[model samples]
Target: MLLFLLSCFSFIIVFKSSNLYEMVSFLTPKFWIQLFLRPVLKNHASFELSKLDDFEMSLLDLHDLALDQILEQLSPAELCSLAGVCTYLRSKCRSNDMWEKHMEKKWGRIIGNAALREWHWYMANNNKRKYSISGGNNGGSFYSICSWWPLNLVFRPKLQRKSEIKGDLPPDSIMAWYLSLETGEFWFPAQVYNRENGHDGFMLSCYDAKISYNLKTDTFQARYSPHGRRTIEENISWSRLRTPPIDTPPYNLHISDCLDDLRPGDHFEIQWRRNKAYPYGWWYGVIGHLESCSVNEDHCICHDSETVIMEFNQYAPESRWRRKKVSRKDHREEGNEADGFYGGIRKLYSKQEISMWKSLWPTKVLN
Candidate 1:
């Protein structure tokens, strides 16, 4: 009798399990989850679990030196992103030492002491005020000048001028000038064109002007040396004449009344306006040196003949004058080259054009 009852109980248990399985198989996945799995997961989630301690150290937890080392490996964009993560990172990112390192990496070789001072000023005041001057569609925007080389100025025929002249423009109408530091001269690009075929080509030329900068007034005063002026006639290809080099000594110009708080490394550029209505393009150059001039009280002029007037020497070639050929399709793209050299034209008319120019001058603190 006991064996018979045990067999019956085992059979009942097996039958119940089989029924349960069949019921689960018949139910949809959603119903199965809601009825069977939800309660188990809910109970498990109710228990508070400690976070893992083996994760990487937070940036704030690292030693300052280690933190700096990590930051040094990061690009400027990454550093900025890290700064945005927390206040602690932001403070570390803004360290003058870090910015100086960045400046050195990007511009140290090309910039001089004056340019560095100007950079310091920019760092201190960039957030407070934009370090730019405003004017027409193509205003005379100043950029940080490279000290080691001269600045190239390419003057293309103004569209308005070209239209007014019915395209009968003089060759001098489109001038290529170079500001050289080694020669301390401002003159046209030493380019000789191959006139045999009517196709235009490039040649190298050397010319410069005597340039002075007034730190107190922030003005550049320039006058061609007797010899420098004469070279212009020779340098003009249309004139078909070569002249002797100017032997005249550098002269002095008093600029104390034109500048205010001028320092080294400050880059100044000028753009000639076709009258007051149309600004053609930019002429970039650098302030090479500054010397205190003895003021003549009688005439309110600087009389120191020995003083080197601010040497507004030239440095680098302008981007437009580069030998690279830019396509019209490339110009249509929206980016840095908006104000860049496009088919030898500079002044852009629409907001899109001005934005394109402004985009070209963006202060990139990164490589």
Candidate 2:
């Protein structure tokens, strides 16, 4: 009797499990999930119990858990990791709101249009400054210094009449000029009486000087012209001056023929065969530290690979001339033509049109 009863109980257990499986198979997936999974997954304590009663309960619980805390504090490196792990987070990482927040919070406040650009990568270690002079009379603007140092320089001007033009000075006659460190103003009260000729032929003089700006050469070259006698081309005491030219050309015959004399903001004119014509091209003065030099046909070729070449302006309307200024450094940089020469040329051409436009219309209303 006992053996017969045990067999019957085993048969009943198997029959009940078979019926449950068939019922679940007949129901839609949504009904099955609603009747069985949702409540257990939302409550972890209940999920463990349902795991014993239902097979799909554990998977639902894990899916809900993944949508919790971990997504909040994601770094760029972390987001990239998420992209590798699964497809869902990859799409989430690319949301525009996330990127803008990353830029704003992780970065500092915006300074200006220029400040927003990644200019730090291109900037050299040298000190640079930007200045502007306004408010004295006619809206004439004075230039600002561009160095990485602090300066309080004042300008004084000495004017001399051009020798060839012989007549009463026209009210608008702008004579020769000079600047003084003693006074902080650019003055043109008296005629420059030094031996140097104002016009017609080349003339030379030696006096303490600071090159404010070189429009032609686009360089900022300065020197102390001592109180000494020197002819324009004849007595260009290359030794007395801080910098002397290493080479000479017929055009620079009256001046020191030192291409090596280039400084940060000097300017010069060059004759280039462009469009089948020897058009006088302008090259801004820049001495990218002499990275390296090689003797080719008895000429030492040096380069300014890292130096920035401002837009090449020839007879640019805004400034009569564009040019260079001088500073001092003992060590020379190395030469890599691809890195320096072409880079400068590229920079020059990249914004050449915009610069030309600004010059052509300094005060036009932009639409």
Highest TM-score scorer: 1
TM-score between model 1 and native: 0.25
- TM per model? 0.25, 0.17
What local lDDT score does residue 272 receive in model 2, on the 0 to 100 scale?
17
Candidate 1 lDDT by residue in tens digits, 1-367: 9985785576557546654335223222333334444556556766332222223333356577866766665554344333333335545654555555664563333334443343345445433432111111211121111110111011111212212211111111100000111112222111111111111110111123323322223322333334311222222222211111122111211122223322233333222222222212232222333234234345323222222222222212343332221222222211133333211212222464234223333132111
Residue 54 local lDDT, model 1: 23
Top candidate by lDDT: 1
